[model samples]
Target chain A: MTDVQTQPAISTAQPEDFFQLLKPRVMSLVVFTAATGLVVAPGSINPLVAAIAVLCIAVGAGAAGALNMALEGETDALMRRTRGRPVAAGRVKKNDAMAFGVILSLFSVMLLGMNANWLAAGLLAMTIVYYAGFYTLLLKRRTPQNIVIGGAAGAFPPVIGWAAATGQAPWQAWLLFAIIFLWTPPHSWALALYSAGDYAKAGIPMMPVAKGAKSTRLQILLYTLVFVPVAIAPAFVGLGGLIYLVVSVAGGLGFLGLALRLYRSRAGDEPDKAEAVGREAALYDVRAQAKPARDLFAFSILYLMALFSALLVEALSGLGA
Target chain B: MRLTPEELRARKRRNVWIAAALVAFIVLVFGTTVLRLQQNQASERALLEAATGTTAQ
Candidate 1:
């Protein structure tokens, strides 16, 4: 009798594994910010159309995320935080992920153009291209200011939402864009301060890895100073109400305080605590010296969420300025 | 080649999800068509009314 060799079964990727390529956590933020813009825009939109527009924006963002993961799979495999991603982990093939992303991107842009306006669809298309092609393929590994320029990709959703609602992107929408654009550097660099080792290992020149922790901290402080005024600008410009004003001012102050503390501390002066301790699970649990960066990173998320939530509530309650 | 039981199960699951996605897309396109037609009709009606008012004046 001839010995029989069993061949490995073809790709066993589950639906959940494909869903993981979408980067659901990041998609949630995109959905929230986009919805807020749609709600806060001056004109009324058909409710169903608005919902579809938000869905399109979210899916478009997710498609960009999938493309990013597909292209960065090798780099992601080198980082502890991203190693579990579908493409990086080999649960989903790179070609499959790329096909999925491209299909979703096309469908989302087409549906948005039909359901809303071509302008909104065009912005969504640009966002996907900017993130996946420009940011991921060109900027990410080439420069430390990657997040600064690439931040425009994340910032476009709110403007797209505004355009979807009013068929025009006004100054207020651009202000919303500016808020996210400024917020990205500080938020990203804070996380980078504690994860510099993973970034360096992945050959990505993140701010902390390229500029040193000291300079990154100072830059964060300077960005926070500039970002807070813009965060508070919505209130003054009649886009935000009293509730938004209070939230933005208070959260801005807290953001500034955390950035100042992070600036004074030696967070990224040494190797990442998790790397030093040889424990990938200890990502959030930084050493005493790195607590400031971790704290700033955590608080920055809360501050941004609070500012947006306040705007959302004010608009929903008919209390918007 | 004979397929393994696990491969068969995975293929079946994927087929079901693909069917669901296709159905959802069909419904979205149908609804969008209906909404767009209604919007266009409303705008046309308004334009006609405005023309009639101008003629009377």
Candidate 2:
């Protein structure tokens, strides 16, 4: 999968391109969840310290993203969806991206250790290693169950945030981690369902490419069924309140409903679930199969955002008091 | 190391930002530590005064 990309010699890379390398959209979610973890935990943090913690999480997330892009430049170039990424497109040199990620990772971890507690900094370091070293390097290329395990990396942000506030991760913080962990299979598999061709072309073992779209759809529905309860568990665990309860129950129903729709989208001409065909839009007939996956992908983002927003608002309002 | 003017200016700005952030964090941590120590001392003084019927001052 090694492609010799002709990088720009002088590297006229702009600040914006470097910013884009961070995968800002993903980092926003990381920052939001981490801030929610900090706020909802049962202690007070200095606002400055909280801000520094969130900034560290954001940078760590970005560092992971850049490193992922740098390492996957070859595969990314082969996939249409990611072909234009800075490292893949040679807008930024691969070595430069690697250096940028390593430096940011160091700065973020050290800053967090100094400003917050070492527990928070240690978790941040683990997140970087889990994502950049484990998930991107080993898991993503090896298994159809890649996201199921790799989801732990994304799920750690809330725990890190809680540790930042209280210097300890109680069971409640891990419940929040479970919410995101279970949420990942469905969210990513939906994207994988539609982008199966990209993965197949790049020789990645994404679920839809390895296990077929039919099984992927079924798994999406199953994971969402499991996701709803965990997403709502915070309310009973004291991490959430009336507002969070309302949002979780309502938002969860929407998520489950969409998953069921995606599962049932495979109508009378459904392909055999056992056929080990490499994924292609044409093979599955995207005109019939793609919409539900796309809808679920979009809705998943909204569901997480709304759930976390309610938690943030409740925490800020002193719900525990 | 020899560097061009524009590159040198940008490097200077980035370094300045990093330094300022570090300094601010150090001040916050230091101030909080001092405040915690002072509060502990005051509480101890109050306890002693209550026991002895005499303020430390």
Residue A44 displacement (Å), model 1: 0.9
Instruction: List TM-scores for all candidates, in order.
Output: 0.96, 0.83
Best by TM-score: 1
For model 1, residues A290-314, the per-residue Cα lDDT tens digits are 8899888889888888988999999
TM-score of chain A, predicted model 2, versus the true chain A, to 2 decimals? 0.91
Model 1 alpha-carbon drift over 4 Å, by segment: A1-7, B54-57
Judged by whole-model lDDT over C-alpha atoms, candidate 2 comes out at 0.84
| DockQ value for model 2 | 0.14
Per-residue lDDT tens digits of candidate 2, residues B1-57? 445566565556656665875787577567556655765798999999999999789
Q: How well is each residue in A1-321 modelled by candidate 2, as lDDT tens digits?
A: 234243222455656667888999999999999999999898687786788789889999999999999899999988766888999887788998999899889888987887678999999999999999999999998999999999999999999999999989989899989999999999999878777767787999998889888888899988998899999988887888888899999999999999999998862123333222533233334445567887888899999999889999988987641
Q: What is the alpha-carbon interface RMSD for each candidate?
A: 1.3, 5.2
lDDT of 1 at A117: 96
